[model samples]
Target: MVDLASLPPQLRRAVDDEMRRLRAGDGVLYGDMTSEEAHDLESADGRALPPDGALDRFIAHATVPPADVAASDLAGYTLVGVVPEGPGLDGPWSSVKRVYRRPDGVLVMLHEWAYVAEGGGVLGVRELMNASVRHGTARCPAQFAIRRAPTGQTVSELRWFTDAKVFTLSVAQDVLADGGKDHGKAWMLRLAEAIE
Candidate 1:
């Protein structure tokens, strides 16, 4: 179980509710895998999907998407790849990633991971940074936070943290910065919002 006492009240409640739903089998698994397929994949490459609540919980707490972006803008994204432990990434955790391509050539990916056994907990900022800045969620506005590379890399990430996992909105820096900081922030926020 997660150390509920360590979390803020609002986040704590969300975690508890999700745990209950997970126990009740009220979770959503994205990829369309049959029992045999899931089992076979698990055997071939150690990538077992989390029972259900991982993605569901993130969606439940995610910020609402901006109204300016159209539904069609979020369409056509699909689960293009999954990396399980062992062969692909040499860890006990597994990740599922989806890709969306807009007509204008902007690409966005939403990725989530969970542990094979105990799931994950909300990580502290220092711990998250030590873990290569991937484990924790952003507590800032939009239910997410953004970090730009100091060296001017053409990629910016907007991350959302849930008690058990992290979701990221990665966009082309040029496309996001086309207008300016406000434009990029708004674009990233819109993508983060449409993730669910």
Candidate 2:
């Protein structure tokens, strides 16, 4: 398991700061929804949310999985989030609500979120996969990947690949960086063990 205690001071601080920022104010940010609410939404809407909403839901949502649900249980499902958009190392892109999921559900989060310059898109599949390996939530397996556009520009495309299922995440400018920072890898590792 990854060690939060072992995290570099800067990375630890960055994650804490981001979490604090996300939790600030009236509305919760990531993982903020109650199971009932999520269940209801899923039943009514038929899919996960975009990053913006997902973050809030993630924050608010119960960290403990339902009695019957396990990390492996999500293998074939798609999760989506609406991420807030923001400036990138380069330029900017339209604020997007992205989707992530694995049709086979073998993968937990087919497309985890990452940040780039304002206009940066996916650069290379390998780079994205590496990012996921480095930055993805501990409880979830790396499912999504980012790549720079072929134009050789900073613009990127955050893409999801699964056995089949598709989920979505909505994002905003503020939270884009939060997704990338290596929060306490230790904490993440613990969370992963708990969930798995």
Candidate 3:
């Protein structure tokens, strides 16, 4: 009953593959029950396999999921990609993220990093302030930079650093019929302030 169709293409495909394998092998919880319901059974009957998900602290190392944010906050964007790295052998030790794009083709990439972790911290705020200056970043509450992207499109980036996490909003310049960095910056700032 999982709505696999609603997931992003990559995630859908991956989950579809896993569901098939599980169904074929009868290895996963399969029934009408919700995951929480199934998990209670899973936990009580546990054989010490492995956790199916990353710890919340580990997930906190990445950008907030698009689903967690209000739809209007996205300014009409839809999530198109996800990079999930969880607590596992080959997956990353921290951080997962999503990519989103709007109808007019504005692309936004949000990335997060934890300042503290169990072993050590992930390094760098994208070398902010240092590199922000090169891109002419200005600070109000945080640094805002309009820099040229590789494709020559401009990016309006808003970044903030805190005791526990670093959050960034990078929006491809030009949005709405009004257009240009001004609109994009307004959009980015609105999204940034709205997030918390």
Q: For this target, which candidate reaches the highest TM-score against the unseen true structure?
A: 3
Q: Give the winner by TM-score: 1 or 3.
A: 3
**What are the clashing pairs of model 3?**
none
- Clash count list over all predictions: 1, 91, 0
Model 3 whole-model lDDT (C-alpha atoms): 0.45
**How does each model score on TM-score?**
0.42, 0.21, 0.47
With candidate 3 superimposed using the best TM-score fit, by how many Å does residue 146's alpha carbon deviate from the native?
Answer: 1.0
Cα distance off (Å), candidate 2, residue 66: 29
* Model 2 agreement with the true structure over 1-109: per-residue lDDT tens digits: 2344465798667656645533322222332333553343333224545445554543343222111114532322454443323233121322323233445321122
Model 2 misplaced regions, further than 4 Å: 24-168, 171-196
- Which tens-of-lDDT digit does each residue in 88-158 have in candidate 1? 34333344444444555554555555422234454533212211222224333223223233343344455
**Candidate 2 TM-score over all chains jointly:** 0.21
> Which prediction has the highest lDDT against the true structure?
3
The segments of candidate 3 whose C-alpha lies over 4 angstroms from its true place after superposition are: 1-68, 85-93, 118-141, 149-151, 174-182
lDDT of 3 by residue, 1-196 (tens): 1255566798677766645432221111111334553342223213222223433433454433322345336635656554444455344434444456667656666655543432444323221232221111433235555444234444455666544445666665533225535455456556765553
**Which candidate order results from sorting by lDDT in descending order?**
3, 1, 2
